[model samples]
Target chain A: MNVLLDNLSLFREGFIGTLELTGASALVAMVLGVIIAGFRVSPVPPLRIFGALWVTLLRNTPLTLLFLVAFFVVPKVLFPDLDSFLLAVCACGFYTSAFVAEAVRSGINTVPLGQAEAARSIGMTFTQTMSLVVLPQATRTVVPPLSSIFIALTKNTAIAGAFNNVDLFNVSKTLSNDGYDIAVIFLWITLAYLIVTYAINGLFRLLEHRLEVAR
Target chain B: MAEVSVTKDAAPAADELVALKNVNKHFGALHVLQDIDLTIAAGEVVVVIGPSGSGKSTLCRAINRLETVESGTITIDGKPLPQEGKELARLRADVGMVFQSFNLFAHKTVLENVMLGQVKVRKVEKAAAAQKARALLDRVGVGTQADKYPAQLSGGQQQRVAIARALAMDPKVMLFDEPTSALDPEMINEVLEVMQQLARDGMTMIVVTHEMGFARSAANRVVFMADGRIVEQATPDEFFNNPRSDRAKDFLSKILHH
Candidate 1:
């Protein structure tokens, strides 16, 4: 208990860092995911093929491998002295975006073809139909899956600790190594992760309920 | 008296409203519409009836370019349809389509659904578009459902809202592709009742449906299709009573008995 109290400040900083990284990465992943998913569904054959290849390549590769490549190898070879945090964020975001793209693509597919045809029959342009009719329905269908992706992303931020980023996991490891009781330090870190994940999951459930009622 | 005078003045030129000349459509190896020729006068209601895969729905969809034609020409209000450009948009805006499934935007209220095309396509003022949308909703007997989403309504109510949405655009021609086929038997009458009222009001329409009763009561001409071809066409009285083609007679017998 004394060890936990002494390491409280380090834990707080670690928690804040995880929050910032997760929030920024989730936002980036969502935007890129939507764009990639749109490309996957595009009528142009080459664009669709390129999007599919991107998803395949990203999804199959290990996240740790991607982080290493982005942080250590790519920067050393290309842009030396680039900020490691930025590299970590970009790597995490792009790695998760492939999963997000698949989730969104599945959601878009679930929207009936009739809805798009109906929009066209009513004289709406293709872009208008997608923006006003199809995308709203697609987004609603994807919310539950997207929420799961976000939770996974939050947990994945701990991977940044592997790069010596001093995230929650790293801070806890450092505290445990520095004469703090290992069990208690790890317990605090586990509790912090559980709280963040549980909060996000609760918000997703609330959103699902609200969407059902609105429907 | 004023309504009678307006009807009389608007009555004569109805025949020249929509015309199709040698319009043909193919879906890869499948020929959907072959040398199809049709003309709908203003205020004339034509019903295209046929079995599944007979291309009756395709025929109606072709008029709005929902399915592009492979050959021949289609003219609306004397304007030849341009294949790709702003002209297609203008042509589409002048024509409205209603589907069998009542494809209302699930995300929007009935009023917003009706007002969307007006505001986005026609650039109508918001308040004025709302007024027009309300009037259309009232016309279709769904005024109370204006604030509700599509899922909240019954199949009949949704179809009525769809009709109102199309009517709000005030298109010169309305094409219905099996508009009530997806409704339950009990719900069929409500939607058909709205369509009957539209026919009475002299709305130019081409309906693709198996609802022979609607054809008997509301349509000016009944066209029968088979195997991607119009096998026969005549006044409903003649088509139902004295179908000349063997296929039409067989189809009529099968449907009427069931």
Candidate 2:
């Protein structure tokens, strides 16, 4: 208990770092995911192929391998002075985007072709139809899957702690190793992750309810 | 009987509202519309009836370029439908279509569904468009359901909303593709009533339906198609009383006897 109280500041700092990393990486991942998903569904053959290739390659490879490449290999080969934190965030974000893209693509496909045809018949251009008619419907259908992806992303951020980044997991590890109450430290870490994931999932549920009501 | 005058102000001549010359269409080695030639006069109600897969629906769709013709020319109100772009949009704006499934935007209220094309395509002001949309809904006897979403309505009510949506466009010509086919037998009359009212008001319409009663009562001419070709054309009374083609007689027997 005494050790935990002493290391309270360390826990706070680690939590803040974890929050920042997750926030930035999740944003990056979501944007990339939507773009890739759009490309995957595009009528243009080349763009569709490229999008398919991206998701296939990233999803098939292990995230740890991607992280190593982003941090150790790519930077040394290209820009030697790239920041470690940025590299970690990029690697995690890009790795997660592949899964997110597949989820969004499936969501888009679930929207019936009639919706698009109706839009066209009424003189809306393809973009207007997609943005107004299709995407909103697709987004509603994809909410649960998207929430799951977000939760996975949050947990995966802890992997960055392996690279000397003082994320929540690393902070707990160091404190517990340094004669802190090992069980308490680990319990706190678990609770923190649970709280974060639970809040995200709760938010998704609220959004889903709102969509249902709107419908 | 309502005394409805067909609009004469800037209206084209009798042969001009819609004309198809030597139109041919196919579905990959299966010819759909073969050497079809037809004309729709202003304020005329033409009903197309045919055996299944007879290209009746395809022909109706072709008028708005929903289904392309392989060879031939289609002109709307003396303006030939261009092969691409803005001309097609302009042409389509003058035409309206209602489907068998009552393809109302499921997410939108009846009023919004009616107002969408007016605001988006015609670029009408919201306040005026809403007023027009309301009037259209009232015309279709669905004004009270304007605030309701499509999913909340019965099949009959939904089809009425679709009619209102098309009417809000102020289209010169309307196409109905088996509009009452998806309705319950009891619900069919409600939709047919609305269509009968439209015909009484002298809307130039091309209807593809199996409802012989509507064709007989409201249509000026009935076109019968068979095996992807128009086998016969006649007045509804003549077609029903004395069908020239054996195929038409057989189709009428099957449809009417059951």
Candidate 3:
């Protein structure tokens, strides 16, 4: 308790960092995920192949390896000035995007073919059909799955703690090294993750209820 | 599958609004449409009737180029329908389609469903589009349900809303693909009534339906198809009263007797 009280600021900053990482990665994942999902469903053959390869490669690779590649090789070749923290965010985001794309693609499948056909019959282009008609309906069914993916993403950010990203897990490890009881520190960090994940769950629950289809 | 011309009914002399020449479509091994030659004059209501698997729906779908034809030319308002891209989309805007399932956007309210094509495709301003959508809903007799989502409405109400959505585009031709077949028996007449009103309003329409009553009452001509071939074409009175081909007589006997 004394150690925890002494490290209150550490906890707060660490938690804030975690939140920032989660938020940034989530935003990146969302945009990339939607684009990849579009490619999966696109009429063009090459795009479908690219989408499939993206999902398979990213989803199969370990997150630790992605983090290492992003931190080491990617910075050297692509972004020499990129911070390790930004690299961590990109690594986690790109990995999570594969899951997000799959969830969104499955959500799109849940919408009947008639909906798209109806939109097309009314003269809407393929993009308009997807954006205005299909995506809205797809969103209603995807909240739960998307929440699950984001929750996983939030937890996965702890893996970045190894590279001194200063998230909750890293803070706990550093404090434990400074003579604080490791079990208690771990317990508190666990609670911190629970709080963030629960917040994500609640946010998605609210969205699900708010955006549910009329049925 | 042989083409049979049972009626010598002279083609209407008005401007040809939709013309199909030697249209052929195949689904893998199944020859779904075989050399379909049809012409629709302005303000004409042509009802296509046949048993299941007879390609009547395919014939109607072909008009809007919804189903790609293997070999054919389809022209609307003196312009050929392109297979894809912006030209096809433009052609589609001039043709409205109402499906049997209503197919109203479930996520959208009835009013939004009616307004979307106008706003997005036609680029109509929102305020004007909304107003026109409301007027169309009212015309279809579902104005009061404009704010409700499609799932909240009954089948008849939903179909009416779909018609309103199609009409909001001010399409030159409206295609109805078994619009009333999916409705409940009691709800069928309400939708038929709306369609009857559209016919009276001189909307160029191609209807694929099982409703012989609608055919006899509203259609200028009835086309009978069997096994991917048009077996007969005649005025409704002549077609129903004295079907010429044996296939038409057999189809009529099965449907009308049942």
Clashing residue pairs for model 2: none
lDDT of 1 by residue, B5-94 (tens): 012232465557888778788888888898877777889888899899999998888888878788888889988877644567778888
Clashing pairs in 1: B14-B41, B14-B42, B15-B41
For lDDT, the strongest prediction is 3
lDDT of 1 at B106: 83
Error of 1 at A132 (Å): 2.4
Residue range with the least summed lDDT across 10 consecutive positions in model 3 chain B: B2-11
lDDT of 3 by residue, A1-215 (tens): 77678889999989998999999999999999998998999767898999999999999999999988988898789889988789888999999999999999999999999999899888988788889999988987778999999999999999888886989988988998898888899889889999999999999998888885334
lDDT of each: 0.85, 0.84, 0.90
Q: How accurate locally is residue A179 in candidate 3, as Cα lDDT from 0 to 100?
A: 84
Off by over 4 Å in 2: A42-47, A72-89, A162-166, A170-185, B1-42, B65-93, B200-202
Candidate 1 chain A least-lDDT 10 residues: A121-130
* Tens digits of lDDT, candidate 2, B26-53: 9999899998887888888889998889
Instruction: Superpose all Cα atoms of candidate 3 onto the true structure and report the RMSD in Å to 1 decimal.
Output: 2.2
Give model 3's clash tally. Answer: 0
- Candidate 2 local lDDT, A86-116, one digit each (tens): 8888988998899889998888899887676
